[model samples]
Target: MKSLNDIKNIAIILTLAYAGITVTFLTYMATSVRTYNEIITYKEHEINLAFGYLFLIGMFTLVVLLLFLFYRAITISNRLLQQADRASGNYTIVESVELDKERRANEEKMREAKLLFDKEVESKLTAMLIFSPENLAEDTAFLEAIMLKMAKEFSAVQGLAYKYNKTNKAFELAATYAYFSENVKQSFTLDEGIPGQVAVKKESLKINNVPQGYLTVLSGLGKGTPSALYVIPIVVDSETVALLELAFFNNIDELLQQVVEQLEPKLGNIYAKFLK
Candidate 1:
């Protein structure tokens, strides 16, 4: 296809050629009329003058027509260039939008896959705990194992299991996993902090924000506050047997929360037998 530049170049060359031809023809006619007027008879001079006037008129009209055609060509080329630029810009914008949509779709698929994997792991762990030998639930070592498993599975920064002390009328810390604090209280009354409250109410609570000075999370890096907390009460036979506390640097999502909730009933049965 001929480009706009090629067409413009052709139009310019034609216009210049027409102008040159017009100038050359006028010069030739003027010189011829001057020579004829000096050499020819008066009657012949008059007749030649009439012919020269007609030829001059015709050449002028032709020059005007060529100039008009050249101007029209330039105008058409400019319009075509503008349209091409606009089309190119629109194509770029559309391509960018399509890429963004594809990126978002890929991210969504990854998120869904991660959720499914987590759910499967949680289900398997629940079945394992439920079907274990009856002797495992009666030993202190089993309580520690359960705490460790819960902390690892949930990615908790710290985990504490508090068995209800009937003699002392308090919840005593029975097991700890990934915990770095020695200053923590050994036990809590039924009305004390969030854990105590969950034990009294016999309901689970998910806290997205922990108040300042309420709790401090310790790690090898340093000590800092946790962003979220979970207080779950283990109940069996209409009585609270133990309370489980978990702390994390990030907020827990709904899928993990649902898994934890499902595990509570089975844990309640195990803890009841172990605490006895």
Candidate 2:
């Protein structure tokens, strides 16, 4: 179909042509009336003048009618073009929004897949620790190895392993990793403190914002209080057998929690063997 602009142009051209023809015919009639007035009788001249005026009026009316039609056509075509442009703009905006949504969804899926892959790798590694040569020797050696592995994996400044002593009715320190304090508490009964609470509850504990004078981490340059503490109890057959404590300079996050989840079961099974 012809575009609006093309139709408007055609209408404009026709209007100008009709206006030019009207002007020419008006000039010719004026000249003819002058000629008739000079030669003819008064009555005939008056009649011819009336006929000439009527023809001129008819021609002028047709010119005005064409011009009005042309104006309406131009107005209609402009409105149609503006509507088309607005529709096109709206479609583009909708498409852009859809693309943005798709991109965000793809990014989320990729993040979830990476998390799953990392959890799998960590699970396999923690499981393989069961067959390590150092961990195969004895109970204390196994506990020490496990503490060391956990401290390194979680970026802990200090770690301690405590075993429940039936005769003493308390949990006694069995192994330490990166421990620097000589006056650190070595034993606790049920309901004594955080460690004792974990022992009694048989569940893990997480503490944040350790007090200023609480446990300090010693380094070559200086010493500072740890920011976070984790106490996990090892439960086997509905009985709490051992407890693990770790202190960190930073806070733990979801990934660390998942690592603990994977390692805890393996630790419980191996330690159960040691108990046997």
Tell me, by lDDT, which candidate is best: 2
> Which runs in model 1 stand beyond 4 Å of their true positions?
1-139
TM-score of 1: 0.53
Q: What TM-score would every model get versus the actual structure?
A: 0.53, 0.60
Candidate 2 C-alpha lDDT tens digits along 19-102: 676666667567774664453455756655555565676568667766777887798897788678767764357766986899
What is the C-alpha local distance difference test score of each model?
0.74, 0.77
lDDT of 1 by residue, 190-271 (tens): 9797787788888899999777756687766888887888888889888887777888878887766777777778877776
Query: In model 2, which residue pairs have backbone atoms overlapping below 3 Å?
Result: none
TM-score top scorer:
2
